[model samples]
Target: MAYKITSQCISCKLCLSVCPTGAIKVVDGNHWIDSELCTNCDGSIHTVPQCKAGCPTADGCVKQPSDYWEGWFANYNRVLAKLTNKQDYWENWRNTYSQKFSEKLQKHQGQVPA
Candidate 1:
């Protein structure tokens, strides 16, 4: 299972360096586990990831996500929105981009390829 960093991570960088896959990331003032990279090699275990060797306890590395994890990307599209939550300009651009991308994706998926 992917190792998730709980709120109890204590902001320590220990596990950050131990993960062999380098799937750990610090975002929104906390550590995050990328499920896409998590292999779940341990059997019958909860959150005791070997990658988190430096963590003080199992509880420290296990946790559910916070309500507003989007806080980390506050400036990802800053060129448009004044703030991440405030969809001012960048938000509009994102919608436009997604619409175009969606159309192209559908077109490509339906192609018979000559």
Candidate 2:
């Protein structure tokens, strides 16, 4: 089975940078994993799917049952193509990511040793 990116994604693009197979896609703010290109990182290079590990949001990347994943791409694309508000969707995601990043940075900065 392959992984899929859910609505919880914050558009950080970490998954894209870490994906070895280049299976994860972000087109017009719609993110999805191409099962055809996704190997789930089964090989020795990584113990976990990089996309999942790199994703900051809990449950951002999820596994799909093999049967359900078979035709997921076509249907997903069909639905996303109908949406016309991609710019707003992308901006919202970017804002969310920036806010979370700022919060985490502040928390970590507080722990700096003197």
Q: Tell me, by lDDT, which candidate is best.
A: 2
- Compared with the true structure, what per-residue lDDT tens digits does model 1 show for residues 84-111? 5665667788899999999999999889
Model 2 lDDT tens row, 1-114: 788988788888889878889898889987889999999988739998899887888667877656765558755764686454365877888899999999999999999986
lDDT of each: 0.64, 0.82
| Top TM-score model | 2
Clashing pairs in 2: none
The TM-score of predicted model 1 comes to 0.43
Estimated TM-score for each candidate: 0.43, 0.56
lDDT of 2 at 64: 68
Candidate 2 runs further than 4 Å off = 67-114
